[model samples]
Target: MNPKELALKAITDVFVRKDITAFDKYFSKDYKQHNPFIPNGTEALKQFLPTLPKNFKYEPGVITDHGNMVMIHGRYENWNGKNMIAVDIFKIEDGKLVEHWDVMQEEVLPSQSANGNAMFPII
Candidate 1:
């Protein structure tokens, strides 16, 4: 699959579907994670997944690609009891996701925004 397709599928499988097999299927064995709260490597991610609240949900929005990197804008619900908007970046190598980074913020309601604009664009 292309980098964008692989990234979207990986994110959906791991975060949305909570499918543990996705770690093996889409992640490199030495996957490097830049999310400070999570340890480096796919194995660590596998161990971390189940600890999230059962109501956790991931909703993907816009996706962009450049060379081997893919960036996805999405929302996370019930993440530590707060909704979040995030831009997740993935580096793909050899058809597997080899690294990741993300910038995230607590989601604010549209009514709370001064400009009345959504953090995530309509997809």
Candidate 2:
């Protein structure tokens, strides 16, 4: 898969579907994570996945590609009704995701945004 497709599938599997088994297929063995709360490798994710709140949900929005790097924007809806808009960046090498970084913000009302639209991409 190209970088964008690789990122989309990887993110959708792990985040949207909440499946860690997909990790081996999509991630490089040396996968490095930049999420502060998470540890350094794919194995850490395997350990952490189940700890996530079961009610949390991830819905992907737009995906952008930059050669070996891809970024995906999505919504993370938690159990308490609090929602977050997040952008996750992945670096792909040899068709496997090798590194990742992410940024997230709490979802806000349209009035709270300067353009009166949600943070996620409309497309």
Q: What is the lDDT of residue 103 in candidate 2?
A: 93
Cα shift from native, residue 10, model 1 (Å): 0.4
| Candidate 2 C-alpha lDDT tens digits along 5-123 | 88898888987787898799999988898999777778878886777787888888988888898988889888246898888899999999999999988888788888898676555
TM-score per model over all chains: 0.94, 0.87
**RMSD value for candidate 2:** 2.0
lDDT for 98 (candidate 2): 93
Q: Residue 94 in candidate 2 has what lDDT?
A: 94
lDDT of 1 by residue, 35-75 (tens): 99888887777888899898899999999999999999999
* Structure candidate 1, residue pairs in collision: none
lDDT of 1 at 59: 93
